[model samples]
Every structure is written in structure tokens, then in C-alpha cells.
Target: MRVLIWILLILALAIGVSLLVGNNEGYVLIVRPPYRLELSLNLLLILVVLAFASLHLLLRFIHYARDLPANVRAYKENRRIRLGHASLLEALHALSQGRYQIAQKSASKALDLGEDPSLTALIAARASHKLKQKGQRDYYLAEAERLAPDAEVARLLLQAELLLDDRLYSQALDVLQQIEKIEHRFIPALRLELKVQLRLNNWEQVLVLLQQLEKHDGMESWQAREIRLQAHQHLIERHGHNLNTLMNYWKRVPAEDKLNTRIAKLAADAFIRLNAGNQAQEVLEMSLTREWDSELAAKLGDCASTNPQKQLQQAEHWLLSHEQDAKLLLALGKMCMRLELWGKAQSYLEASISVQPCAEAHLTLARLLDNRGETDAANRHYRLSVQACEDNK
Candidate 1:
């Protein structure tokens, strides 16, 4: 279409020029100092048109020649980038399928092909690590760091992993700490830092890091609980005398979280360690009110009091509510015998055995009956304890 338009335009211009030339009745002359030249109007017009067209074509050729090198370089770079992309994708797929050797090969090829060498280096390092090629892993990691020095996150993460692999907890911690400083609140870095701290028995830092992790919606509740247990264990070891500090720690935890069976159980143990028998009793009582766990119920019975009568009475009350809880029944029976309530102890102990016959319950009953001088029944229970123990074995 465009060619046809150009042809039509040229024809119209030619006809216009022809009419102008034909209508011309006079000519013009050009003169120098001592010479003169004269030509037809058509000849001068043709010369001017040829000069303009030749000049335009020459300028266009100059421009095209100037851009050729840059366009070729761009094309080569683009091809290299595409090859790198393909190599990276292949490596990732291989890694997912557990083909560590193949993944390593592809990642290396990507780096060699002049792809984003830094990224390829990182991938190669990971693949090498999985393949257990320690030398290659270290070399690739070093290259990645050299290629992208400002990528502190990737460098520290790799270093942290290496230190962890070597069981160098302190070194890993140092690297992770530096990463945290460089990139505050980085979840991946913080997670590694948390694990290193745990290995170093640094519970205080574990608590703080866990709170930061909780801010990330990706963290699971179970993971948080595990961290809490570690933190609690550490606090108990370090601050056993400071009830106020421990209480404040508990207060900072969400109320619903405190209600977790694991946390509740931990809290009960903590209270018992503190020798706050009354508080432990209260906490366990409240816990048992909602959950009839045999383990918690047993612990609750033990935490009731030093006074055997009071302990026995509390256990019995719990038993009324949780009659099916054999552990609670055993605890109550054991306390009754401690208080010398022989008949009641026997009844409770026998009931525990009936509900869930175990060595523990049988042994308790045997001891209780022996204490009351009921020789025949005590002998029978002793035999039952031995039988139960053997069965479990």
C-alpha cells in the first residue's frame, strides 16, 4: 500500500514539474568572472533532486553502520540470559526430584554460560552441598560472595549453614547475628539464628527470636509452643529464685496459649519447681476443670500438698469428676495410704487397677495392703504388679 502511494506521489510530482517546464518560455544563466554556463530549466531541476536523494541514502548508511556493533552485543547478551534461565529451571527441577548430581551439573553450566553468575553460583553451591561435594560447595559459595558482595543475606545464610554442618554453633551464631544486624527482622536469618542459639543453650535469645518469628504469619503454633518450652526450661534454670520474673513471663504469653495442654503442663511443673504448692494446686485444678488428662490429673494430685490428708482429699474430689482417670485414682490411693486411711486406700487403688491395670497401680496397692498387715491381699497385688510389668515388657 505504502509503495503504491509513493509511486503515485512521484508521478504527480513528475507531471507538475513537466507542466512547469513546458510553460517556461525563458531560461536562466549562471556566470563566473571570465566564464558563463547556461542550461535548460529541466536539467537544473534533475540535478537538485539527485543530489538530495544521494545525500539522504549516504546519511542512512552511516547511522546503520554506527549501531551495528551495539545491536549484535545486545543480541548475544540476550541469548546468554535465556540459556542461563533454562539452566536454572532445569537445575531446580532436578533438585526437586532428588537428582543432586544432575542439579549440580546444570547449575555449573549456567554459571559457565555467562548467565547471572552470582545467582548461578548460589544455586551451584546449594546443589554441591546436597551432593556432599564439600570442596565444590565452598568454592561456589565463595564465588557467589565475590560476584555479589552486597548480597549479605545470601552470604551469611550460606556461611551459617556451613558452620551448622560442621557443628560450630558459636560460629553459626556469629554469622546469624551479623545477618540480623544487616537485615533486621529477616525471617530466614532469624530462624537459623534461633536454631544456633538453641544448640548453644541460649534460651533467653530463643524467646526473643520466637516472638519475632510469631509476627510472620507463616510460623505454626506448634513451633511456637516448642520454642516456649525451651524458653521456659531455660528461665527455670537461670531464674529459679525470681518468682516475679517467672510470673511476668507467664503474663506476657497470650491467655489462650497458656491454656494449651503442653504449656499448662509446663506451668504446673514450673510451679512445683518454685515450691509454690498452693499456686500449682490452683493452676492444675483450673486446668483439670477443662481437660481430664490422666497425666495432668496425676501431677495435680502430687502438687496438692505436703499434708497427706489434704492431698488424699483433693485427689478424691478430682476422682469424683474424672472417675475414669486411672492415674488420678492411683495418686489418690497412694495418698490415702500415706495418711493411713487403709480401707479407702485399698478401694481407690483397686479401682485404679480395674480401670487401667499397670505395674505402678498394682505396686502401690501391694505396698498399701502390706502396710495395713493384710498379708494375703498384699501378696496377691505384689504378684499382679510383677505380671503387669512382664506383660509391658
Candidate 2:
């Protein structure tokens, strides 16, 4: 178009100059000494202008002709991009409508147009997955991964989710680990990593993840503490068969923690297993001191009265506070009987039966009375003891 315009312009100039020259009588010019040339100046001017204009127009036309293929290619690329954009929009709409087949078709068509190859690969992969085309889905995913080595988080997350859904826990962990290696402490990746660790029973890894979560206040304090406690308990139980490790671990646990009723109970059992009744007694005493637990109090009293006079004193001190509880009363009664304090034993046994009647208490009192030569009262109490067990049942 520019070439045609230039040519027209040159033609108009040529015609104007020719008319001016034809209307003029020829103009003469003088030359250097001993030489003169006669010429029509206006006609000479027109010829020179026409020659330059022709050369310029010829060069322009040659350049434009040389660029024709490139222009055609550019036009085709632009048209393809527009089509791809339209196809992508249609694919997205179809996907939203749950038309998996149509979405796959449109996405493929979009990829065939001039869309970004990496983006095209992802859309095609997702669409194929939705359509249950496993082979095609894997191929597209592989292609996308190759094209964009720096994979998108959303795509990686989806892949991990799929692996998890299939119960491919190790594979899912591998993916999450890769993401962590690339972008350490990425929140979603770390969360998925923790979940994978939990699924695999990698308790050590879970503890570390829990610590990280705690730093961000991501988990409630009690929740984190509960998980840690569970992990610690598991670790302890795992090594419980090894006496040295179990003893060492138990000793290293903080004294305050040992006062927890559950911990105290477990520790007491462990101590009994190790034949360290004294340590068990100490744990029970500490636990009872913190809170009045009938269970711990009873265990403490039992342990104290098991062996010697010193532990008896400990049982007596505990009983001073819990004497009203029937279980504690029974414990005290048995301890006094073991010590041969028959009178004190009878007092406690009677007190226990009075507060909360139990077959054991009635029988213990009856036996004390019988041994003391009160046979008639002993027989009465014995019969009442038999009836008590049956009535409670």
C-alpha cells in the first residue's frame, strides 16, 4: 500500500514538472571559460526528479515483497491465539458444568491452537484426569512437568491429594518432601508433610512438625500437648522391654509431670514391675498431694502398708485426710490388721461399713469380732455381710 502511494505521488510530481517545462521557452546557462553548454533547465530538473523517485519506489516494492511471508506468518499466529483463547474459555465453562468429555475435547482443541505449551499441558492433564483417561492424564502431566520444571504449587498439591486418596502414602510423602526441599517452610506443603508423617507412624517427624505448627500457633496448645504426650507415651512403651532405657526415661521425666494422675499410675505400675516399690510410693504420694484422687490415695495407702512400720506412718497420714472415703477406710482397716492393731482395725472396718456398706468391710469386721470372742455379734455381722454382697449385685 505504501509503495502504491509513493508511486502515485512520484507520477503527480513528474506531470507537474513536465507541464511547467513545456510552457516555458528554454532557459540558457553560461559555463566555464572557453566552453558553453545550452540546456533546458526545467526539463533537466524534471528528468532528475523522476529518476530518483523511480529508484526509491522500486526499492520499497522489493522490500515489501521480501517481507510478505513473515507478515502472513504473524497474521496466522495472532488468529490462532485468538482461537485458543476462545477454546480455553469454553473448556473452563464445560469443566464448571461437570461436562468432563466436552471439557477434555475443548481443552485439547485449545492446546492445538497457539496457547502456552506448559499451560496447555496442565489444562489437558486436568481434563483428562476428570474424564478418567488415565493414560492420557499421565502423559499430559509428564509433558507439563517437562515443560515447566518449576511446577506450580496447585498442580503439585492436587497430585499429592490424588496419591493420598489412592493410599499411596509414601509417594505422597515424597512429593511433599520435594516441595519442602525447594521451598522450605511452605505452609501447605508442611501441613501435608505432617499428615503424611502421621499416616506412616513416623512419630519423630510428627513431633518436629508439631513443634513447627506450635511456633505459628497453628494448633491449639492443648492439641499440640496432647499429640506430644501421645508420642512420648508410645516411645516409652516401645522401649519398655529394655529395663535400662525405661528406667532412664522415666527418671528423666520432670517431677511435675510425674504428678499427673495418668503418669503417676503408669509410673507406679512400671516401678512395681521393676520392684521399686519405694519409688512408686513416692510418685503416688506426690500425685495425691497435688489432687485428692481416691484411686491414687488407695494405691499409696496399699503400698505404704505392704511392708514396714515407716510406710505405715505414711498410710496413717494419708488416712487422716481421706478417712471418710469407704475405700480409704478399708485400706486403713487392712493395714491396721496387718500391723496386729486389732482394735484400730475394728474401728476402721466399722466406719467403712457405716458410710458405704460393702461385703468385704462387713466380713472384715465380723472376723475381727470373732477373733476377739464376740461370737454372737460376729455371726450376725457375717450373715449381714453375705446379704450385702447379694443386695449390691
Candidate 3:
């Protein structure tokens, strides 16, 4: 539409100029030294317009010619950038698909083409690691660090993760420490450090990391609970040989964690092993008061408190609520035996056997019968104990 409009305007102007020129009686004369020239004014005007148009076209052509080399360079540079971007995309897709070799090849190509050098190198590093090519992986990681010196945290994080996968825990921990020096509270780095600590059996560090992860919501509640339980159990065992150390450690344990049955059982057993029966009893009571566990109840009997009657009272109190619990019955029987209430012990043991028939209850009952000179009954109970153990297996 614009071209048609321009063409009509040009025709209209030409007709107007022709009518004016045909009516005009004008002329232009040029003289120079020995030569003179004369031309009609309409023709002179046409020559002048054509001369201006030709000069504009010639200058435009010259300018285009002058810039042609730079334009070619720019086009080549743009094409390289586009191809590098495509290669980077291919590398990312192949990596996600687990085609490690292809990912490595494409990432290397992108790196050579200078497409975000640090990212490309890191991709190649991960691919090499997946293929178990440690040397090449290290090379790429070094190149990544060298190419992007400001990305220390990213480089160190990847290094730590790869070292962890290799089971090089100490080295991984060193790398994580480097990251911590730069950004102390990084969540993903903290999570990786937790695994490293756990593998290295640094139980104290494991506990610390668990707290950090819990605070940051970096771990599931149930997962943190399990790891925390394991860490506390190990710490308790580590201090078990010294009664004062064990008790001190127990005192520092969080109140909610002390209520966990498994952790409570461990602390109780550790205290009992160290002959700190009062501490064991305290731990068991605290745990059982929060929630009754049959295993913890059974462990309660093992605490040889100075006051046997008091321990027996505690077990009997638990019996009011857990009457059908076989382990609790066995524990009550053991407690009763400690207090020399033979009749009560016998009754509780028999009740435990009737309920579940475990080896410990049968064996304890046999010992009690043997003490009373009931040889035939003791032998029968002993056989039953052996049979129960075999059935359990």
C-alpha cells in the first residue's frame, strides 16, 4: 500500500512539473573561460535532482563496503554463541538422562566454544565422576575453579559431593570446611557435612549438624529423630566406662530425646554397665513415665539400685497399666526376686510365661525353682527355656 501511494505521488508531481515547465520560458547558461553551455531550466532542475540521488546511492554503497568485514565477524561470533548454547543444552539433557559419556562430550564442546566456561566444566566434571574417571573429573573441577574464581562455594560444594560419593569422607569434610569458611550456614553444604560426619563416626559433630539441619528444615522430622537417637546412643556408649562421664552426658541430653525408648534403653544399659544403677533407674523411670515400652520395662529390671524395694515398687506401679505386657511381667518378676519375695516372683514369672513364654522368663523361673530345691520343676523349666529360645530363632 505504501509503494502504491509513493508511485501515485511521484506521477502527480511529474505531471505538475511538466505542465509548469511547458508554460515556462526559462533557461540556464553556464560559461567557463573558453566554453559556454546553455540548457532549459526544466532540464537543469532534472539534472540537479538526479545528481543528488546518484551521490546519495554512491555514499551508501561505500559505507556498506567499509563495514562488510566487521559485519562478517559479528555474524560468525553470533553463530558460535548459538552453537555453544545448543551444546550446553544437549549436555544438560544428556546428563539428566544418565548418558554420562555423551554429556561429557557435549559439555567439553561447549567449554571449548566458551559457553559459560564454569558451568560447562562443572557439567563435564560430574559426567566424568559418574563414569568413575577420577583423573578427568579432577581436571574439569580444577578448570572450573580456575575459569571462575569467584564461584568458590559452587566449586567446593561439587568437590565435596563427589568426594563423598567416592567414600573419601575426610577429603569431603575438608572441602565442606572450605565452603563453611566462605558461607557458614549454607543448607545444602550443611546437609552434606552431616553425612560426612556420620560416616567418619564423629558423633559429637553429627549431633551438632543434626541441630543445624533441624533448625533449617533441611531434614525430615522422623529422619532427624533417628539420626539424633543414633548419635546420642554412640556418645553415651563412648562415655560409658566412666560413670561420672556417662551421667554428665546423660544430664546434657535433651529432655524430649531422653523420652525416646531406644535412646532411654541405651542410656540405662550404659549406666548399668558402669554400675550406676541409680542413674539407670532414673533414666528408665523418666522414659516409662512419658510412654511405656516393653523393652524399656525389661531393661528396668537390670538396674541394680541400692534400694531394691523402691525399684520393685516402680515396676509394680507400671503393672497396673500394662497388665498384659509380658516383658513388664518378666521385669516385675526379676525385681521381686531381688527383694527376695519368692512367692511374688514365682507368680509373676508364671504369668509372663503364660502370656508370651520368652526364654528370659523361663530361665528366671527355673533359677527360682532351683533355689527352692524343686529339682524336677527346675529341669522342666530349663528345657522349656531352651525350646523358647529355639522357637525365637
Candidate 4:
């Protein structure tokens, strides 16, 4: 509708101009010696309008021509950016799909195209690592670090994780330490460090990491608890060779952990091995007071305390509440033997055999019988002990 109105307006203006020109009796004349020129004013006006329009068109063409090269360059740059972004996306998809080779290729292409070079390099590194191309992985990781030094944490985290997966725990630990220097409270880094420390048998560091993970909610409570238990157990074993070191380590153990049956049993056995029978007895008694365990009760029998009478009294006291517990009965038999109460030891050993018929109980009973000059009974019990051991196996 606007175009039709414009057309009518132009036609009307043309008609008005033609009428006015036809009515006008005006002309321009020029003479230069022998040459003379004459023209109507209306014709001159029309020529001037055409000249202005042509000049405007020429200027527009010149402006477009001057900018052509730069415009082309900008267009190519934009195209490269778009293509690089597409390649990056393809790399991510291929990586997620487990196509490591394709992902690495695409990410490398993206990196060459200069699209988020650091991110592309990291992606390529991950893919290379997955492909077990250690050389390429390290190269890409170095590129990532060099390209974006401000993202040191990211590069270090990836490097640590890859090293850990390769079971190069010491290398992973070094990388993790670098990350800690940059960002002390990174949860993922801490979790990775935990794994590295565990693999390295750095129980002390494992405990520290576990504490941080638990505090940050980076690990499940139960999972952290189990790891903590393992760390403490290993720490105990690590120091078990030296009596002073073992005692110092045990003293540093948290009171709550000391009551755990497994930890207590391990500590007790370690103490017994170091000839610290009193300490072993103390650990067992403390753990048993918290929670009863048959294995712990059985282990208690091996704690050869200096005060045999006192230890025997403790085992007998336990027997009052655990009359049917086979391990407790065995412990009582061993304790009675330690105190040289042969008749009581024989009764307790027999009772323990009646309850569970274990090889240890039978062997203890047979030893007691043999000491009393009952060769026939001792022989029969020895055969039963062997059979029991075979049955258990």
C-alpha cells in the first residue's frame, strides 16, 4: 500500500512539473565567440537531478570497494571460530561415547583452530590418556598448562588423575601437592590425593585427606569411616616393628577408634608380637567392654600377660555373661592354663570343644591331657584336632 501511494505521489509530481514547464517561457543561452549554446531551464533542472543521483551511486560503490578486503578477513575469522566451536563439541561428544581416537583428533583440531586452546588441549590429553598414549597425553597436558597458566588447578587435577589411573602414585602425589599449593580446599583434588596416598601406603596422609573429605562432604560418612579404619590399621602395622613407635602411634589413635573391634584386635596382636602382653590385654578388655567379638575373644587367649592371675580373673568374669560363647570358653581355658590351674583349664577346654569343636580348643585340651601323663586320651584328642583342622579348611 505504501509503495502504491509513493507511485501515485511521484506521478502527480511529474504531471505538475510538466505542466509548470510547459507554461514557462524561460531559456538559457550561452555564447563563446563563434560557438553558441541554448537550452530550456526545465531540461537543465532534469539533467542536474540525474547527475546528483549518478554521483551518489559512484560514491557508494567506492566505499564498498575500500572495505572489501577487511570484510573478507572478518568473515573468515568468524567462520573459523564457528568451525572450532563445532569441533570442540564433537570432541566432547566423542569422548563421552568412549571414542578416544576420534575425540583426540577432534580436540587437537579445535586446539589448532585456537578455540579455547586450554580446554581443547585438556580434552585431547584425557582422550590420549584413555588410549594409553602416554607421550601424546603428556604433550597435550603440557600444552594445556602452557596455554592457560591461570588454570593451573585444572591441568594439575587432570594430570594427577591420569597418573593415579596409571598407578604412578608418587607422581600423582606430586601433582596433587602442586594443586594444594594453588587451592588448598579443592574437594576433588583432595579425593584424588586420598587415593594416591592410599596407593603409596602413606597412612598418615590418608587419614588427613579422609578427615578433609569427611568435613567437606566429599565422601560418604560410612565410606570415610571405613577408610579411616583402614588408615589407622595400616598406621599401626607400619609402626609395629618398634615397641616405642607402636606405643606412640597407639597413644595418638583416637579414643573412639581404639574401641573398634577390628582396630583393637589388630593393635592387640601387634602388641603381643612386640612382647607387650599387658598392653594387648588392655586393648582387648577396652574393646570387649564396648562390643563383643568372637575373633577378639579368641585373640585374647594369646595375650601372655605378666599378671596371669588377673588376666584369668578377667576371662572368667566374661564367662559369667558369655557362658555359651565358644571363643570366650577357649580364652578362659588358655587363661586357666597360664595360671597353672590344670583341672580348671581341662574343664574349660572340654567345654569349649563341646560348644564349637575348634582345632585350637582340641589342641589345647590334648596338650593339657598329655602333660598329665594320659597318653591314650592325648592321642585321641590329637587325632580329633587334626580332623577338626581339616574340616575347617
Question: Which numbered prediction scores highest in TM-score against the true structure?
Answer: 3
lDDT of 3 at 158: 93
**lDDT against the true structure, each candidate:** 0.79, 0.76, 0.92, 0.90
RMSD of each: 5.9, 10.1, 3.4, 5.0
Model 1 TM-score is 0.69
Per-candidate TM equals 0.69, 0.53, 0.85, 0.78
Q: Whose lDDT is higher: candidate 1's or candidate 2's?
A: 1
TM-score of predicted structure 3 = 0.85
Rate residue 342 of model 4 by lDDT: 91
All candidates in order of lDDT, best leading: 3, 4, 1, 2
Q: Across residues 185-242, which tens digit of lDDT does each residue of candidate 3 receive?
A: 8999999999998999999889888999899899999999989988987898799899
Query: What are the runs in model 1 whose C-alpha is more than 4 Å off?
Result: 1-62, 94-114, 131-136, 201-205, 227-286, 300-304
How badly does each model clash, as a count of residue pairs? 0, 0, 0, 0
lDDT of 1 by residue, 1-393 (tens): 999999999999989988988997665599996989898777777788999999999999999899989989999989988988899889889888989888889989988887676677877888888777889998998888787787768877977987887788988888888887898888888878788888888877888788888878537878887777767766655655667776777676666556666667777788778877666666676766777678877775456466656666666776677888888888787667657777887888788888999998888888877877889988998999999999999
Off by over 4 Å in 3: 1-56
Q: How do all the candidates rank in terms of TM-score, highest first?
A: 3, 4, 1, 2
In terms of lDDT, the poorest run of 10 residues in model 3 is 245-254
145 in model 1: Cα distance from truth in Å? Answer: 3.2
TM-score pick, better of 2 and 3:
3
Better of 1 and 3 by TM-score: 3
